[model samples]
Target: MAKSPLFERGMVTRRAVLGDKHVDGATARKTDFDDDFQTLITEGAWGSVWSRPGLPRRERSLLTLALLAALGHEEEFAMHVRATANTGATAEDIKEALLHVAIYAGVPAANAAFRIAKQELAKLQEAAE
Candidate 1:
């Protein structure tokens, strides 16, 4: 199948935010069943939205984390937390975002997200060591 321009752009933006190793692993694991699903997100989420210049990646990262946490999407929230290192979002920034989640999205959601964030941040710290 011919890759659309949007898919190409999305691949670049996805790599920039998620890192090449992560993206490569996901690509290698792609199956015929999920190939289209993968393409949709690559084009829709990474290409059209993430590639836009309206908001910097740091801010986008924060928004994504908050939304994922509020919706109780634990896995995606953790992934985005890990992606923070590449997004230029500091631990402090994540704290503030989670605090908002606690107030607006409910304490339970925020609490769970906090735990995941802590674990993911620790992993990032250890990786840097």
Candidate 2:
């Protein structure tokens, strides 16, 4: 089937935010079983929502991190934390977002997110050095 326009837009925005390496890896690992799932998020989340010009990528990054942490999605949270580099979100920004999560979402959730964020941030740091 031909790709939807939203999916196309999402692919471009997703690559811009997540980087080629990550997107390439994900595409490389795509299986028939998960292709539809990937497309759904690409179109719905990345294309339709992220493609909007109102919010800067930096704000979206922080919001994504908070939502992931609040929802206890450790893996995606870590991924978005890594995406901060491309989004212009600093470590300090992440810390503040997680602090809000601690208050609104509960401390335990934020605590786990903090651990994951630290690990991901360290990995990015090491790669830079």
Candidate 3:
């Protein structure tokens, strides 16, 4: 099937934010079982919301970190933490967002997110070295 324009836009946006390596790995891992689901997110999340110009990618990165943390999506939160490299969000920005999670979403959630963020950030720093 021909990919839609939205999906094409989403592919560009997703590659911009997540990098080619990660997206390539995801594409490689896709199977018939999850292919549709993958396409959905590529089009929906990356195309519709993330492609919007209303907010900069930096702010969107922070918001996504907060929501993922609050919802206890640890793996996804950590991935976004790493994605900060491409999104222009700093560790300080992530700290502030997690602090809000502590206040509004509860300390426990923020606490776990902090742990994951710290680990991921350290890995990023190490990779940069």
Candidate 4:
């Protein structure tokens, strides 16, 4: 039997983009109320746009960070910003994005993103060194 397209593609893309440990941890945390939210995001966001080949993963990561920063979605922004370390987007890349956010999305938005990104980047740096 063929695997259902939704489950197979999303699981593959989700694992690829987020890493096994992250996805598995997310899965472990899902409750009945949030399970649908999890599935929707994994199958839609990860399985669809993130799986697209139009951009390199690093470029996509940069774009995701910028949009999240611009929108003031602090929690999601920080999560994606932290994912930058895994995607080879450095702290400098995040700084550049925040600079753009300051110009277009307002200074306070950029300032908050930078503060969060700094903590996240510091964690990555410590993990590396």
> What shift in Å separates residue 67 of candidate 3 from its native position after superposition?
0.1
Which is superior by lDDT, 1 or 4? 1
Clashes of 2: 0
Task: Give the 10-residue window scoring lowest on summed lDDT in candidate 3.
Answer: 74-83
lDDT of 2 at 126: 99
Once fitted onto the true fold, the runs of candidate 1 whose alpha carbons sit more than 4 angstroms away are none
- Residue by residue across 19-69, what tens digits does model 2's lDDT show? 999999999999999999999999999999999989999999999999999
Query: What is candidate 3's lDDT per residue for 75-107, written digit by digit as tens?
Result: 999889989999999999999999999999999
Q: What global local distance difference test value does model 2 have?
A: 0.96
Error of 3 at 45 (Å): 0.2
TM-score of 1: 0.98
Model 1 Cα lDDT, one tens digit per residue, 1-129 = 799999999999999999999899999999999999999999999999999999999999999999999999999999999999999999999999999999999999999999999999999999999
For model 3, what is the C-alpha lDDT against the true structure? Answer: 0.96
TM-score each candidate.
0.98, 0.96, 0.99, 0.89
Which of candidates 2 and 4 reaches a greater TM-score? 2
Each candidate: what lDDT? Answer: 0.98, 0.96, 0.96, 0.82
Q: Local error of candidate 3 at 124, Å?
A: 0.4
Rank by TM-score, descending?
3, 1, 2, 4
